[model samples]
Target: MADNTAINIENIYKKYNALLEGHFLLSSGNHTKFYLQSAKVLEYPQIAQKLALSLAALIKEHSIEVECVCSPALGGILAGYELARALGVRFIFTERVNSEMMLRRGFQVTKGEKVLICEDIITTGGSALESAQCVAQQEAKIVAFAGLANRGFCKAILPNNQKGNEGSKIQAQSPICKLPLSLPLFALANFSFDIYPADSCPLCKDSIAYKPGSRN
Candidate 1:
């Protein structure tokens, strides 16, 4: 039988050696000692299903309605597809063409259609935000964001802006992710690591930092 128990995402990464401790570059143009290569754990279909199912359960607990799941292409495709399958919702992805994220392949979102953005891992949620923009351009409503793991720059559940309107921005923050604070981010676990910008990266003083994940 399939294991339906709660999963410890960190442990899974450890088991697969997906968690690495070293100076590395992130897609967000930040440097960190630790890197989570979710592909290592997700390469196994069974494990991917289990993880996706758990994420789906978390989303449903919030009573959030989603008609579709959209993920940034390349890194998020597997996790997104698995999540969509678990949620019984359709899945589509956005790809970068000429340095801009576009929704190609004849995919379409109806006006105000509810969508949930999924990612394998969210560092500063840059890619996810780009995907959200694509959905927003289609006039679809982004209900929430989900990821397998969070880098802990932001909390899993964002604060309430009950008095705010649709175009309101996150208050009291410099906007690392650029995602609105009103939209909650759901993740299985929070992986807290020290992140530094390229200019001030301490690791760059001696060791060379390499871009590990897909994205410039």
Candidate 2:
């Protein structure tokens, strides 16, 4: 299989009905004209493997030691597991217990164990950070973070220090990720779409708001 780059991912999304158009209520409480439904794409095993292989390649290029791959519950499960498979590392996930992410299901990380945090889509990187925090709580080291699609918040800095979306006019770090700039964020592609707060969204005025996302 060919290396799944941004264009390849975008095309796969379109083919899988994962990329959608219209007003959507994002998990971040913002509104966007487009949405990336990662589950839809991951539903196909072959496609999921391709994406994971690409991500693993990136991680290997950096020579990042990965003892385990950790992901947030619900959304990141599939991608995280697949990436773990590609990397031949253990897979664990954090789930919302009492509205807070917890490392449950008998999962445990030892002190100084290298871990990679992953997700399907990184908008504000809230979930990924939460998962990373869980890993930290276990005294584990977060080697890096990876995602399939960057929702403009996290920049895709490959091991070679190249921007994943280099030469693309649409490149900007969103106020979301909040992680230290020194931390690396690797993703296959960057899709920068317009998002607005509910109070000021133009779509809200027209009553065009419709929550088409997985989030309630």
Q: TM-score, each model?
A: 0.89, 0.89
Residue 34 deviation, candidate 2, in Å? 0.5
Mark the regions of model 1 whose C-alpha exceeds 4 Å error after superposition: 1-5, 158-175
- Model 2 lDDT, full chain set: 0.81
Q: Candidate 2: give the clashing pairs.
A: none
Per-residue lDDT over 34-73 for candidate 1, one digit per residue giving the tens place of the 0 to 100 score: 9999889989999999989888877776788999999998
Against the true structure, candidate 2 reaches a TM-score of 0.89
Span of 10 residues, lowest total lDDT, candidate 2? 159-168
Between which residue pairs do clashes occur in model 1?
Answer: none
lDDT (10s digit) by residue, model 2, range 1-216: 335444366788999898998888887788898999998999989889988998888878767899999999889999999999999999999998787999997999999999999999888888888899998998999988889888776666532233443522335565666554556777877777888987789877666677765445
The Cα local distance difference test for each model comes to: 0.83, 0.81
